[model samples]
Structure formats: structure tokens, C-alpha cells
Target chain A: MSGEQTAAIESDIEAAIREDHPALITYITAGDPSLEDTKEYVEALDCGGSDLIELGLPFSEPIAEGPTIQAAINRALDAGTTPARFFELVDELETDAPLLVMTYYNMILQYGSEPDVRPFVERAADAGLSGIIVPDLPAEEADPLRDACDEHGLDLVFIVAPTTAGERLDRIMSQVSGFAYVQARLGTTGARADVSNATHDSLTRLSAYDVPKAVGFGVSEGDHAAEIIEAGADGVIVGSALVDLIAEHGTGDAPAADALESKARELKRGARRGGEQRNGHEQGREEAPEPEQP
Target chain B: MSETESNPPAEDEPNRERTFGDYGGQYVPEALMPALQELEDAYQRYVLDNEDGFMDEFRERMRDFGGRPTPLQRADRLSKRYDREIYLKREDLVHGGAHKLNNALGQVLLAKYMGKERIIAETGAGQHGTATAMAATHLDMPCEIYMGRTDVNRQRPNVYRMRMNGAEVNPVDAGSGTLKEAINETMRDWATTVERTHYVIGSIVGPHPFPRLVRDFQSVISAEARDQIQEQAGRLPDSVVACAGGGSNTMGTFHEFVPDSSVDLYAVEAGGSSLEIDQDEGLAPNSATLSTGTDGVLHGAMTKLLQTTDGQIVESHSVSAGLDYAGVGPELSHLVDTGRVTPASVDDDAALNAFHRLSNLEGIIPALESSHALGFLEEAHEELGDLVVVNVSGRGDKDLETVLEETENRDLDAAPDVEVFDT
Candidate 1:
């Protein structure tokens, strides 16, 4: 973040994979409960073994969110979360893990407007943010933001839905740099009973790319994380489950942080188990050291 | 060589690359992309292809079920007042009482062809919802309609009509609890149930393919009126007018006349109070996207929308539920940019006056949405030609409750001393 250029998000994932573990990415609404506690939660999630943390800048209308994340966003908005405030929170955040901002495209489009340029990318870069993920901005409409992100040396992550067609998939995979986000189901984000077979099939289609892939949306439990990682995902993203924890346990209590940390460890454990199983049968593969569990 | 092959293919605008300057694009989540692409392909394959007989079947439904070729009536009394020949393209005579059934029946048929088992739509005034429910019942398919809770309260009779037709009505309470919020809920439902569901978008204002497809289905209104005006008036009318909510009725009433350069096209928007008022007050004008809104994205398409400087979509207000949206269709925005269409605004009070005037003068109860078009007649340029055609887009049956309430309120305000005790 200083004189030395920050490591690319792919490099961070590679390093984690070299240690025989798939990355565990966690998402939380930045101002849910409170913005002050949000800063503390980021560091705690990192300490708890999360490889990356995605800060969801709350919006008034979250069209793609289910009831859980929608409630989190409503609470955050009620608590007064604005783009300026979220950027200030990011500027003050102190964490070793890579930080990414997740929001709708309009939120970024509104914050800064120039002729054929995105100001949000430069603002995010100035805030020491590593990457950005906009759920509504597809590859067909991502050129301006992608160019801005490239100029700012920030990663612009793209998503791959289960129903993504072949040609559209090729277009989406072309520009994404941080990692490709793989939606685990055909719907909005929420906890579900099981991961669909379509996810594995979609991963098989995406396996042609060198980019790390993270499975989100309904990857709530440890087994779900393991299933996705085993199906060839490089990481697992757990959002609603983690946000629900903060919602259930008051953010003022220590048990909230403890519960979050414990959930992070469980997901990391599943990721590691999946990674081991991937290379266990191949004795010719290089043996890697394991990172300590939380 | 085949006729189509020899003809070098007709220039198809609907099938053209989808964008309007910087407005219309896929702004939806990745999960809905595949379904959108699939719908685009199916639409072109089944509905757009005239040789498939699919469009013939759709036209049959429009004739037998929807009572197509709605009469073009002369508004002689109103014409005398405005000093012009005003003819009303009476879409109110169509079954289900509005121009919405044109798009609804077309899409519901397409859904049946695509093997979808469920259909869903979002509505504000309940015209589109009732139309969709009617189409679903005719096809014997299950239907669900999402309405804003606020709108459901005001539009109770339509709610009962939908339920009576066996369509489930879901009242959405999020956001301003209006058309835009209902659209969000319907999109959510489609994203989750794309495997077996078809979303019958009510207007021409969503992501690509939808805007194009809906406009195509509704183009029949102008097509019929164009022929009728030519036969009766000896030429195309001097001006064509309709109210703009999401711009469907206007687009339908304006498209065929677009190529006729001599004809002027005017789109009347719902000016709730006035265009200059602050939108946050909940009393400001609505459907003024071309007049007061800036370029932005809303409900998946880039278009002119009422939004804050920070890009939050603002709630729009109108006495007429059908014309109460905050955004206009992308194509309408494009037409405005190119100067092909003139956008005018009529406030709620003026629209109500026109509503009662049309009712008393012509013995026709006009929907409030249609009244906006009639209200614009008062401000027509003095130099314009005598013949003008305005689309009477819907009947007023569904708005009876709201109209009665407003009439009572106006009467009370007119006479403060009058008081009646409950019997």
C-alpha cells in the first residue's frame, strides 16, 4: 500500500493455494450495526483466517439481494451509510488481507461522472482499496470502468452466473483480473439448503481460464464451502451467513467477533480439506506447508 | 433463391444492436443474463419470424379475444373548444379496457410457445396486471402479479378482478411501494424462477429485447389508427398524442406515424403538481423523465429517470397510477434527443379537469392516464393543422374509487360550510 506496489489479488490467491489452502472470502455491510464496529470486524475477520474481505457499501435499493442482505443494507442505510462515509471508513481501515468494495453499478456511476470515465475507480484506488465488484455491471457495459480500473492499478472482478451463455462467458472472462465470481445458484444471494449441480458444470466451463474463481451465493456452511472448492473453485465466499451472525449477536458484544472468527475458521478448514484432497492422490505434486488455523 | 434470401433481408430495427446512445443496456445481475439471452433468441425465432405462424396466432387472439381495430371516434364538442379536429383512437374499447392487453396477450402467447408454466408482471394502476391475468386465464396458465402496497389500496377493484381471474396478487412494501418497487420484486422473482417463468413486462422500459419486443407488440395501435385516419381524414392526422408513463402507449400510438414526416408527435407526461417542484416532497410531477430527469439507469435500462444527484431513484407522484412512474422508455428518450417527439407536461388538476370535461361533453368516462393526453390539447400550438389524433389508452372503470374520492374532496373544498351527519 506504500512505496511497494500492492500484490495483485490473483497473486494473493496463488500464495494461499501454494500453502495448500483455498482462499476464504467474507462479505459484510460496512455500516451495518455501526461503522466503527465495521472497521474492527474487518481486522477480526482477517485475523480469523479470511484471505480477503469484501465491504458491501449499503444502497437504498438492493435489487439483487434476498431478505438477509436486504435487511443488513436497510439497517446500514438507516445508520447513515453514504459513499463518502464508506470511502472514509476504507481509508481508515488497517488490515493485512486484501480489501474489495462490493456495490451496485449506479452507486459508483453517481459518485463520480466524467466524459467516458469512472471516478469511483480512481477514488477507490486513492482509498487504498485492492479490488471492486459491481453485481449489476456486466462485461457488455464494463469497458469504461475496466479502463479506469486499469489506469488506477485496481482489480475489476466480474461474475459468472450459472445461466451465463458460452459467448457471454468468454466476454466476461476476458477483462476480469482479481478473480471471477461464480454465483452458486440462479437467484439472488441467500442461504439455501444445497448447492446446485449447475455450479460444478459452470466451473468446468470456466476451468479453461487461469484466473482464480470464488463461489458465492448460498455457500453458508463449511460443507457447502468444501463442495464448491472440491468442484474446482479456488475460493468460497460466505456473506449472508456472516452478516446474519452480526445481526443475531449484537455488534457491541465480544461474542459477535468471536462467532465471526469461528465461522471464518470453519470455512478455511473446509477450503483446506478440499485443497488437500485435490492433490493427495498425485504424489508427484509439490508438498506445501499449511497455514495455522484460527 | 428464397424470397427472403433474394430480398437481402428487411431492415429490422427491433433486431438491431441494442443501445440508445448510452441508455439501454443489460444492467441486471449476472444471474439473469442467460435468461435474457434465451428470451431474446426465442423472441426472434418465434414471434419476430412471420413465417412461423406465431404472429398470426397472436393477431387472432388480439382480434377474437381483445377486440382489435378499436374505433376511431370524433370528439366534436372538444374539437369545437380547442378549434381543431380532434379524433380519439378509442383503445378503451379493447377488452380489459386498456392498450396494455396488446403487449400482455402477445407475451403470454410467446410464453406458452416457450413452454413456460408461470407468468408474472408488475403493475401500478393494475391495468397491466389485469390484462396479464386475463391472458393467463385464457391460456389456462398460472399467473402472479406484483403491485405496490400503496397502489393495491387505491386500486382495490382491479385487485379483486385479478384474484377473480385466478391470478395471485403480491403486494410489495419496499421502497416507495409503487411501480418501481414492484418491478424490483418481479425481477427478483424472475431471477430465481427463470427455469419455468416468463416475465411479461408491461411497458417499453426495461433491459434490451424487452423494450424492443414490447414496442413491437404495441405498434398495432398506431398501425390501425394510421389506416383509419387515412381512410377517414383523407390523410394522416397533423398530430398524434398519448400519455407517457413508461412510454408504451405513446410509443404504440407514435411509432407508425413516425415515418410520416408531416405528422407531429407529442407525448404528454403526468405533471403531478409542476415539473419544477422538488421530487422528494411526494407532491411533485411524475412521468416527466424527458422534461425534468437526467440520463441514468433504472430498472435495468439506461434512460431518463427521476433520481437524486447521488443516483438514488426518486418516487414519482400522479393522480393516475398508470402514469406515475419515475422513468421513461429508452426509445422515447432517444426520440426526444433526436427531436422526433415533443414532450409536454400536464399537471394532475388539469388532467382531472379534462377527465370530467370529456365525460360530461362526450359522455365517455376516460381513464386519468388518458386524460393527460386530452389535457395537452389545451396547449397545442396555434399554427398546427386542424386534424389531431389522441390515443384514449384506457377506460376509467378501474379508477372509479380514486375518482369518486377526489370528486368528494373537491366538492368539500368548494363548500366549507356544507356538513352532513352520518345517518
Candidate 2:
């Protein structure tokens, strides 16, 4: 839990955002089929061009997840995924990309014999986790966890929904470390056939915040990644789409790891293509606009 | 807590405390924060401040449509049997046959004032759904209810009652298909439809404004009972007992009397078959959260919960669907922790026995949820002072099938003989 270790996630995300292309963030439920499979999947995602990976510590009541991830969580829980076991998996993982633990607030609150956030945050930092994402912990109730994360030097990422606005949005942005998770839609996390219009509006709304913005929710394919990135997101997050692959192929299946790797590669390429197109359009507009000025 | 101080400030003061001690807070997704904020504003203006004659209309509607001020009857047979003056707060007499309408009606009316176009809610035993449906129909608002598929099948009559009152019952089939899942599904709906829809949480649970909001509406139960007992019995009762599930009725019956230190408040939970939790299976054999639960966050609030050592919420059990919840209201958790309210529990057999005893002795059939309180009285009446007031939270009409099926499986000492009649 050293200060240098705690700053890993924010620094890694910042470096990734500074690259020529938008950062690609991939998510998979830890211990979905088995912890061994999760380790392999994380390595695959990292090698396939993921800038950061989020490992879900399965909670029994994941109100923030949709059917695909919920089924994966139930599978992980049935296979006996616990907070202690999740940390052990994180400790064992070897990946090029920094890792974060996405879980419900209760798991952190009840990590020890009593309800305290420090014990869990300290353990997360020790396990080499760069940041933590709690969908249920809004800015209004995030002070204790934020303080704990600050003390532990781990980033505390907050999700900003389309409905989020005004003073609340300002408060959340001020507290957020690493990248602010910008929900691409108004609902819970799931993969959709197309990117939502709300994604563009939300990115515009969050333009004033200094934190890097990563758009998630309803992001399914390479095109979705490209669309979100083109609309001005620093990163693109895909979860349900990757989890759907695990659900389709049992973790024991040899192709499961390969499927995740291929999907990650495609999403990363789309993000790069989007960055090139946006830069080209901006340069074209700058060169052609002077004569039309009134 | 004083009535005025209990109302939170309208503005979002960063330092304002939204919790009851260490419990309660808006532990919900960012999408629902605006809805909670809007609801808080509406609650403060219309509910606490009574803006636009809101409280006047609400009280008038309760009297005209909901049969408010349900009588406080002195149970003659129960008084003699317990050797004390037993008073029953007859909440079962409220319209829709449960104390649920007190909160449901108030929330629905408040939604109308806030200009919400639709209403949504979740129910376990269907009492809350039925009450909300009735209120919505009475108020001319569209309504929908999320009910577990398991409960939808078992509580058919209440399901039909809800449908008859014009509510679409969506059966949630996820994770055990029970109250917990229904609540999650309802929350999911609210998260997506926050602007146009208002989710009427049936109990005094959930985030900051809801627990306080629901409590204010349901407090009418104690508001009347406290005055009724003083006039009827010439003094306040020594002990007040109510069943605890999500604790709407318990909080409703206890809110007015909490400051009266002389009077004792008891929240009787359903002990089911046992209190021992099977850690390996992630199951708790009872719904006795107040009695044996640890502090954990659930359903948007930091409350007492039945959870495993690894922080996984365990599946809870109770023969009575209404009492089958793993979490209790955060306010109740604070009350129990501070020792303002005593926590007790009764087994399923005892609750079943009390259901029959009240029917046979006093000609009043009690809901299985309410039977838990009656069972507690039967177990510890001698310790209660000369006067005791018990809240009959609902009628037993919805529990006839469940009681009959459960009674046939066990030999309840007080159960009336029911030999199968020749078909």
C-alpha cells in the first residue's frame, strides 16, 4: 500500500489517454467459470491491446448489471468467489495493463468483521489494484470510501449517468480519480446493438471536468467503441459484450480466451480508427474555414 | 426525534447527515440520484410543509376512500387470557386490508403533486401491490407492480386484487424469485424511467428520503393509536408490539411513542425454522435480521442484513411471504442498536398458532405477519405491564391458503381441527 503503488491506476490511465488512440478498457467477471480461467483471460485481454482491465468481484445482488453479467456473476458465486479469493486472483495475475476491481459497495463495507472501508481499500492496494468502481456509491455517500482510497493511494472512479447534472456532477468530478466512468445510457450495464445518443450528450456535459472520461454501458462491438470515441470519450469500456463470450463458451473451452482476445483487438483497432478520423476532420475544418468567416 | 427536525433541509448541504446514526444513505446508482433529489424536494414541500393543501387533501382522501382512523379495539378475550388490558390497533381495517395503503396512498398523491405520470412498486406477499393499485385507481393514475414469480403464484388472490384494480403485475423470475429480486427489478425500472415514473417503495427501507418519507405517511397509525389509547384506557399502554419485516408497520406504530420512555416498543421478527445461518450454502433459516443480522448495505441503504461472512447476501426464509426479507429498515436498525426498541422473534409454528388463536378466541383473524407479534405476546405477556397494545398490521384473508397448507404439515397447538370434509 505504498503511495507509488496507489498512484498506478491514475497514472496508467493518463498515459493510455495520451497515446495516439483512445484507450480500450475491457471487463470480465473474476471466477466466472474459475479463477484460473480469469487469470488467463486477463493476460489475453492485456496482450490484445487493452489499456486497462476491470475485474468484477461477483456480488450476489448486483443491481447494476444486466442479464449477461448477472448470469456470469451467479456462475462466479456458485463457483465460490469471495472477496478474499478475488484478491488472491488479483495478486496472482500478470498483465501489461493496470487492473481495477469493480464491485458493489457492500462488499467493501463488509470486507472485515465490521463495516469499514479502510481494510478493504488497503487490501486492494496491497493486491496491486489500481482503482475501485462501486456503481452504488454515488458522490453523496462516497466521502468515507473516497477518504480511504485517498489514504491508500488507489483511484476511486465514479460513474456519471446521463441524468447526472448541476452541482452533483461537479461534486462527483471533483472527487473522481483515474477516469470518470461516463455511463453511455440511462440504464444498468449491458451490451446494445448500437451506441446511444445520450453518450454524445453526456460527453459534452462532462467536457468541463478535467478527469478523463471513459464511456460504458450498452457498448457491444468495435463500431460502438469507434462511435463513442469519435463523440469525444478518452476511453471505451466493454463488459457485457466480453462477458457474453464467456457465457457462450464455457471457461474450460479452449476458444474462450481466444474469443476475448480477438474482441479486445477489434475494439482497440476501432478506437484507433476513430481517433484518426476525428483528428483528420478537425485538421480539414481548420484549413478550409477562414474564407467563410462573416 | 422532533417532527420539525426530522425533516431534512431542501437544499443539498454537503454536511447534512442523511443517515440514522451509522445506517441509511443514498447508496444507489448515479442515474437515480436526481430522482431521489427530486423526491426529496417534493417530500419536503408537499409532505413536511403541506404545500398546496396537500396534507388536507391527503387526510380527506384517507377518511373518504381509505377508512382512516381505524378503531382501536380492546380485545376482551385476549385481555382475560393474557391477564392484562390488551388493546389492538386495527390497521387491518384500513382500505386494501393492510397498513400498506397509508404509505401507498400518501406516495401516490405526492407523485400526482410532483406531476409524475406513472406509478411503480414492488411487493412480496402482494399486500403493498394491492394497496398501491387501489390507491392509483382511486387517484386515476396508471400503475405497475413488480412481483416475484414465486409470490405471484402463491399469493394469487392478492395478485388478482392488484390486477382488478388496474395494475400490470410483472413477475420477476431472477434469483430465488422473491421480494429481494422484485425490489431490484423495480429499482432497475426506476433507474431507467426516473423522470416519468415514481416508485412507491412499500416499506420504511431504501435511501435517505424514502425511509423518512414512508415513515411520515405511515405514522398516522401511531398518531391515532397514541391518542386513542389515552382516551380509551385513561393512560398510555405500557408496551406496544408490532411485527417487523421491512418495518413499515413497526415504525408506523412506534414512531409516535418512541419519545415516551415509559412505554416499551417491541419489533417481533419471523424466526422461520432456525436462526443458525448455513454459511456454506449462503442461506439463513430465518428472516430475523434485527435479531441476528450484521451491518451491511442492501436495497440502497446501509442497514442490518442477513449476509454470509464473505459479504454475500444469504437467501432468507419465512413461511409468511410478507416477513421474508434479508434486510430491515435502517431506522429500525438504529432504534434497535440504541435500545429504544427491543428485538424479538417467533417461529413459524408459533405464528401459525397465534393466527388460529386470534380467530377462534377473539373472532379476529390476523395476517401471518401480524401473527408474529401476537405470538410474541403469547410467549412473554407476563413480562409486559398491565396494559399492552399490539398492532394487527393486516387481516388473515390473504393467508387462508398458506395457513391451511402450513397447518396441515405441523401440529399447531392452537389450530382448530380441520378434518378433510367429504368432497
| Highest DockQ model number | 2
- Candidate 2 CA-lDDT value: 0.90
Question: Which stretches of candidate 2 lie above 4 Å from their native place?
Answer: A1-10, A287-294, B1-17, B420-422
- Looking at candidate 1 chain B, the ten consecutive residues that score lowest on lDDT are B1-10
Cα misplacement distance, residue B158 of candidate 2 (Å): 1.5
lDDT tens digits by residue: candidate 2, A12-122:
555655553488999999998888889888988998999999999998888888888989999999888889989999998878788999999999988977888889999
Q: Check candidate 2 and list the clashing pairs.
A: none
Pairs in clash, predicted candidate 1:
B23-B302, B272-B285
Instruction: Judge the docking of candidate 1 as incorrect, acceptable, medium or high.
Output: medium
lDDT (Cα, tens digit) per residue for candidate 2, span B266-342: 99999999999999999998999999999999999999999998788998999889999999999999999999999
Judged by lDDT, which candidate is best?
2
